[model samples]
Target: MGLGWIRRRTGHRAAKNQPGDLDMEALIPDHFLCPISLDLMKDPVTLSSGITYDRQSIDTWLEGGNFTCPVTNQVLRSFDQIPNHSLRKMIQEWCTENKRYGIERVPTPRVPVMPNEVSEILFSLAGSARNLDHQGCFECVRRIKNWAAESERNKRCILENGAASVLSAAFDSFAGDCGKKNAIVCEELLSALSWMLPAFDEESHKYLGSKASLHCMVWFLKETDDLSVKQNSLLALKQLLSCDDHTKHAEALAEIGGVNDILFKLIREKISPAITKASLMVVFYLISSSSSAGEKIKLSFLEMGLVSVLLEMLVDSERGVSERALAVIDSLCDCDEGREKAYADALTIPVLVKKILRISEMATEHSISAIWKLCKCASRQEERVLVEALQVGTFQKLLLVLQVRCGDDHTKEKTNELLKLLNPYRAGLECIESVDFKSIRRSF
Candidate 1:
């Protein structure tokens, strides 16, 4: 009877003290809570406004392009954040006392990198690059990359300290060097540049767009077996070509012999979905930048068998890859040579028809646009293309697209035109059936 009574009492106490049954917020001191997150303060820091918050929460608020305090709503006089060591210690003590309540003590936060430290690192990198000290450059760049990965605050500090300019200068300085050590240094520099891309200034963009820098990227893309090196190279090229003078850059890329072939090879290899997408974007940007360049590049791409590669990409690629592939195809079909190449490929029309209303609105739009060009612009091959499209259920798909309003006004217009082109033959099944695939093959 005594044992039974003790067991009943213990069960009641355990149930009463259950963590889920307790109001943890009520137990914690109000001042111990971060104003931003309303949770226990970990790594508390004080703003210039005399308001305290968790370091991470405040860092996030500042990093989100805000120049004012979250609580006070006053414009910040400076970006300096002072560590609230006293409050952090108090919170830790409270957590230690509440260990039985499942509270864990927050670990001490590491001090964020300051602007001066970033400046020193950049100086070291510049000096190493100037002296042709590949080893020193590699070490400095690796450290910078580590800092970039540490925290958003570190990244902000690094960028503010002019890391992008220094890195680009180093990259341009080492442009002519070719050796294992230099290659490794170059790769590290590119990786660091990739991290700083979002913060690249006008000067950095100019340096990256220069002839030597562009060639360096092309060299990495063509020679390096490292996946990361190739990826970073593609990313840099994509950024450079995305600027306002993209046509000039595109022409520059073309002047770098074998760039088109290199990009096509990357796409054909299917190394990784990201690399493939970047390669495709570079190609798309290259051809779509200027009409003259576009026509020349499209013709060159067609001769190199770009249409077949795009058609194959459409089969099982991710939505983004599929959308880009369709976009490229749409761009390609703008030229007569592009349309002929697309028509010559047996998979082209069927792939375009299959893609409509299946992938995305943009994909549907691009697909419809390409089909319009192939069927409407083929001149002598127009009838044969329409017959082939109808045979492959293009007529029915077009009608479905219209009923569902799958694309934009332009797509709707193309859809209606294609329907009109195929409607007459839709009733004449024997005329479509009698169309010779052999004759269509010869028309190409």
Candidate 2:
């Protein structure tokens, strides 16, 4: 039985009350419903334009990039949501009257976070915190994180009120003293900082500038066995290192030690697919950021035995993993040392030839680029590297790449250059003649 039955039987506004056949939802007045959620208001709050809504609904709407009042369609002057005490009291009274229909009063929501509250949370996180203090700081940070997650307004409040500086200070405090430090607090703080990184704009650089923070990241990667801490640290490091100014800090990153070792070790360990992808993204950003730092990054990767590991990843079935591996090889092969190492591998030439058009367009470009670099050496100095390419059917692969109509223009251009370079030496490769090299030679 419901209010619909009663309305159908009576069909009049002055009909007697049918409490025995009513729904709690039917008893709630339309004005007491939130426009956004279309539900009975709980903790009703008023916006700047005098439109009222449930606090949770409006906060979620504001956080999701909505700035206008849902009912009036007027642009909001501010995000402030003042409590509608009178309306809340009326809603509560109505719910009480309908208590027999299973209506329960809404509990008062924890006070909506304000700017000063964010500041207080940060203030508690600073200094030499130990034991119970660390636990208390973690709890405070958890509260701020919860509030920020609630909506975009809280995120703005936290960032505008010095959240970044406080996080950096907390990082310093945690790193400065060890007697009270634990992985739980450290991971939570780093994750919170990571969440806020995107919202900080240029201030992100200042927070990440701390050597202690950088060292803490490296320590997390190298020393911690906790999976979550490692992932958060990697994400935070990726966020920081992907910036354009990484060139200025590349030298310092290199000097901090263990960076290359941990990256390669994680790659070889295959901890998880996400961790590996993130590690590859970090390496790609670092190597591709600047030409001046490329050699250093290449040298470190080589010292950490990255060539063999990357060669293994190149064959992975996952396209993203293999594509990133090829990209890394392309960047690593930019230097003479990287070239020497890659050229020495018997599988390197064959794998590069095999990947010509079998993978993505980007992978095709990277593969051709790697072969181009290798053949440049052979064409200029008639080095044995050219002989190795010919031995592994490199020219045959290039001919296939040239014939594929679906390949990108960049791959076609590189293929043409490689064919031209090899044309001069076609007569010397008489050892392997499975295809009509002369026919392919004429097309080139």
User: Which residue pairs show collisions in model 2?
Assistant: 63-152
Cα RMSD (angstroms) for every candidate in the order listed: 8.1, 8.9
Best by lDDT: 1
Model 1 Cα lDDT, one tens digit per residue, 137-209: 9889988888878787788889888999899989887776633446777777898999787678778988778
lDDT per prediction?
0.81, 0.71
Off by over 4 Å in 2: 1-45, 53-78, 82-112, 127-136, 149-153, 177-185, 200-204, 286-294, 353-361, 379-416, 419-444
Give each model a TM-score. Answer: 0.84, 0.69
Error of 2 at 212 (Å): 2.7
Model 2 compared with the native: what TM-score?
0.69
Cα-based lDDT at residue 444, candidate 2: 11
Give the clashing residue pairs of candidate 1, or none: none
- Say which candidate scores most in TM-score: 1
After superposition, which runs of candidate 1 have C-alpha atoms over 4 Å from their true positions? 1-26, 60-79, 96-104, 179-181, 291-294, 399-405, 428-444
Locate the minimum summed-lDDT window of 10 residues in model 2: 1-10
